[model samples]
Target: MAELESPRVMSKLISFLSSLLQRVAESNDLNRRLQPQKISVFHGLTRPTISIENYLDRILKYANCSPSCFIVSYIYLDRFTQRQPALPINSFNVHRLLITSVMVAAKFMDDMYYNNAYYAKVGGISTAEMNFLEVDFLFGLGFHLNVTPTTFHTYCSYLQREMLMQPPTINSAESSLCMGKSSKLHLCFNDDESSHQQQQQQQLAV
Candidate 1:
């Protein structure tokens, strides 16, 4: 847990989230430009009006969950999207999904996490809505809450590599080169699935 709170870990988490927000922004911009006719029919039409950075800042300041919980929340987000193909992460639902994932991760990973009501208040949502979202997200994830050490490290490494590959600014001429380097990092995880599964099985047997 202490390791989770370390500066390195926190930086990696922030970088990972920043990348996701960047993607969301790009996707929204592309939709606005290339699909103007279909924009009104987009699922993100009902998405929250809040900025992703501001929303994440609110959670960082008020959620009071372990820093590790944020990392776990990222993992849950990945698993949730994989399991529920219908609910892809995007601007329309990402904010709500972030709050639900972090709340659920905190509850599962922290022994002293706040209750659903408190989480609702922190997330600026009704308690009942929070409860409903929690239930829905749990089912969406199929209750696979356990993350092995190997998997955790793999994610951390991936985020760190991405951070290193991100150009300092959007207009940098080297941005494309940096993105190419980042794409290569996916190979690091290509062989991780079998090892991660084996680690999970060993832990379960213990």
Candidate 2:
């Protein structure tokens, strides 16, 4: 935790995350192009001009959530892809996905965060689209917003290992070959506030 507070370590962390996501999105896009897939709500009519690295850096700049949110956002993205196999991350929708994941992660993990309007502006989308994406993403994850300490550590370890293997540059080509795409997250919601609070507290403790 102390090391993570250092500016240099934080920069490196962001670099590793952006690099990993960029590579994964590029690989998925290539695979998606080879076999055209059905368009989902996440897809845009045209791919955004911004690069994933720049988009992420912009989020880090404007969204003042803790650095840990980035890791949680990555987890959310992985879960989203696993659940919504038809809507894999690609250049066409990666920017929106990144913003949604980060914003959702901030809401789940942080004590305070920007509202949909602010996040929408930060994401280069409208408030209505941001709201729509939030609901869709939460529903897609089945509102399974909790992350256990073990799971968190596992992801952190994975990122650290990848960082060691690849250069600390967001433009690196090396990354996980493919994101897993087998199972679907159960898409059900229960109005259980106690359970939700417990999950949030557990994640906060971690």
What is the C-alpha local distance difference test score of each model? 0.61, 0.71
As for candidate 1, its clashing pairs are: none
- Residue pairs in candidate 2 whose N, alpha carbon or C atoms collide under 3 angstroms: none
Q: Best candidate, TM-score-wise?
A: 2
Per-residue lDDT for 200 in model 1?
14
Return model 1's CA RMSD, one decimal.
7.7
Give a tens-digit lDDT track for model 2, residues 80-184. Answer: 766777776777778888899998999888887778888888899998999999999999888878876656776677667666786533222222223223212
- Candidate 2 regions exceeding 4 Å error are 167-206
> What TM-score fits each model?
0.70, 0.80
The residue-by-residue lDDT of candidate 1 on 4-85, one tens digit each, is: 6676767555656756655644554445444332221113446577776677778887777778778778778777655654
Residue range with the least summed lDDT across 10 consecutive positions in model 2: 182-191
Q: lDDT of candidate 1?
A: 0.61
> Model 1 reaches what TM-score against the true structure?
0.70
Per-residue lDDT for 74 in model 1? 77
